[model samples]
Target: MKKISFIGMTLLFIACTPIRNTNIKTNLLDNNTFELSEISTDATYGTEKNPIQVGGVASNEGPKNERRFLNALAGPNGEAVTYFRAGSCCPIKSKNDPFGSGSVMLDNYRVTWQGAKDTVSIYINMYDSGTLKAPKGFTIKK
Candidate 1:
């Protein structure tokens, strides 16, 4: 019936609307990709002690935002960067917890570039948004 079709169209419209046009808060290459523009000189910025907070998880878009951030980085001297999810660890309290559990776990990504002797771990928090920056020894892609 037309009533059912109207309801379906309404849902579709709502689904396509962005949860938060946070592209203004953080540079974006696309709806799902983050374009990093800064570098963190602080040694602990991306370490286990202080993870990169990419957020968007409360909107069910955390994992995608995480990859977008990683994809926007290069090596310290502008070499192509590659990374993988090492695992999730270090649960911490957050106001953006999607589950209302008051805590969200951090995701660890091991990153490296050619000629690098060893991979470095980058800690990321997908549950809370922050001004994203490349970790020390990494560079932002142009």
Candidate 2:
């Protein structure tokens, strides 16, 4: 009887237990924010469906050229545009600058959802001259 009761209690405990939330981090930026600009939930470093995420766009100069599309890490997305610089220009004119000589950079993005309510931060070690990081990672909820 004692053995049977212990087994039943163990099973009950297992059944009532909840799955623990997991945290994952990845190297988002290596070189050239443009390389990171092409980022998408479908093409992250390792797993395709990481709950946290970030990304956006910036023009070489002038007003932001690309639209913004942001989302959470679990599902919602974030940021949509990027910018890059070109060697043809010098001192880099902010206005009336030719985009041909410039490039788009997409770096700096983050997502928060469910167990993740804090802000997400993207780190870039090094890159070319033309690249813009996202302002801030988006917030998400479960």
Candidate 3:
């Protein structure tokens, strides 16, 4: 009974552990990288006042690669920004597209920076022509 309990506990621990993918390469426009001090996905999207989104399918990149690329963006004042995977964008059917010829997946991420006064939201596009770089007026940590 004790052995069984130990095995069950070990399995539970492993199952509950969060896995971090270290093999993903950073693919920001300028090779920019940022340390995530805090991250959350509890925000709305597509609203009139706070309309921020980002991301789309890359030719040879998957969601994991896209996330790694986005992890490198910093806040306006160099504060750690939060990422929210809002959803996908319009669908495109192209037989020659790398992301499968039937549907083009565009990922939308709502990036937010919590400042002293208030929170700011920025929209990002990860479509075919999406570029991974800090938006205008925003700065990433060197």
Candidate 4:
């Protein structure tokens, strides 16, 4: 009985221990830049092809929810879009047309996550006539 109780306690302790935190590599390559390549970009919406900036967390995720990575997209025409509270572990299941700040012309602009076949790669579709920029800590999907 004592041995069984000791084993139970040991199991509980192990379970309670925090696992090693997974982080998005801030410096993806040899360069210490958090920027990721744009998976796809289209200038067909307008004559201007907006520029994109990227970044992400080096480490940190929470229980029941992963750390949020913010992707900011901005255009030269004073338009900007931000993907807020984006989940790292799970793909967004549905499409959403989130409104942007007044400076951006992204009303009813649709965003869809096509699901990730690879954890290292994120698959997303966005209709942003504006530019995309990420925080000092996040990056766009390469």
Candidate 5:
């Protein structure tokens, strides 16, 4: 009876343990493409004092794009990185020409660098212009 109880407890403990994703080393957004206007970094995660945000329009190419972009970022020591979509801001609208144009599609992402002790939250905004630029303190490569 005691042997069976011990085995059951062990199984329960194992099952309850959370699993971490390890195989996140490939470009998930290989097919999807978008031009990044600016990239910014903030020390605070999410707080009133130092809000986390990006400049320009925020937009997403959908789930595939988000996954690909997040996976492509490397940690300080080239570690694998994972990300989750935190939220988004209101979409801006513009009207003038036949096709109607607007700017600022901001998207927020919470990025985690596997094997690293710190995590970062960033925002990616897709602008109408086909240009990519990094903010004063941040840099991005495509």
Candidate 6:
């Protein structure tokens, strides 16, 4: 009975523990945006539905973080990029969701360049901080 109770408590503790957000301390620039320096090679990096996981801005700064990530990207050939919020979708399991919903929905953005005929869609999860990078077929700002 004692072992069973201990095991049950351990499981509960693990389930409720939130991931630490100590990874991006050095990557942020003045709280205005993130300083991304690499482009993602994984095709699924940005195409894996509406959860790009490209940044971490916590709950209050979620929208701002999404914009900062988009601002860091350029077209395949370094063309000027423009984007707008496409709305929120995809509830990803996250420890950073402040609402205690156990998950956070990602923000979708439709990005386009001056000469591009079609827009690229990216899902962003600002609640969870991940390695920030530009999606494939895109470039990062210098």
Best by lDDT: 1
Q: Report residue 62 deviation for candidate 6 (angstroms).
A: 1.6
Per-candidate TM-scores read 0.79, 0.21, 0.45, 0.22, 0.41, 0.77
Query: Candidate 2, residue 100: CA error in Å?
Result: 2.8
Which ranges in model 3 have alpha carbons more than 4 Å from their true place? 1-60, 92-103, 116-131
lDDT (Cα atoms) of all candidates against the true structure? 0.85, 0.30, 0.49, 0.29, 0.45, 0.75
- Displacement of residue 42 (Cα, Å) in model 1 is 0.6
Error of 2 at 80 (Å): 18
Assess candidate 3 and give its TM-score to the true structure. 0.45
| Stretches > 4 Å off in candidate 1 | 1-24
Candidate 4 Cα outliers beyond 4 Å, as residue runs: 16-18, 22-30, 36-142
Cα lDDT of model 5 by residue, 28-127, tens digit: 2345433443454544422322332222222333344444444445555555556677787645542211234543345667766656565566655333
As for model 1, its CA RMSD to the true structure in angstroms is 10.6
> How far off is residue 36 in model 1, in Å?
1.8
Question: Which candidate do you rate higher for TM-score, 3 or 6?
Answer: 6
Query: What is the per-residue lDDT of model 4 for residues 96-133, given as tens digits with 9 covering 90 to 100?
Result: 22433222221122222234222122222222111223
Report model 1's TM-score to 2 decimal places. Answer: 0.79
Ranked by TM-score, the better of candidates 1 and 3 is 1
* Top-TM-score structure, candidate number: 1
**Which tens-of-lDDT digit does each residue in 1-142 have in candidate 2?**
9999999999999999975321212233222212233333333332212211222112231111111222212233533322222112113222222355443322333333444445443322111222322333322212
For residue 37, model 5's alpha carbon misses the true position, in angstroms, by 16
- CA RMSD for every model? 10.6, 19.8, 16.7, 15.4, 19.9, 3.7
Candidate 6 lDDT over residue span 51-72, tens digit each: 5564445536667778777877
RMSD (CA, angstroms), candidate 4: 15.4
Task: For residues 16-42, write the lDDT of model 1, one tens digit per residue.
Answer: 986743333677887756888779889
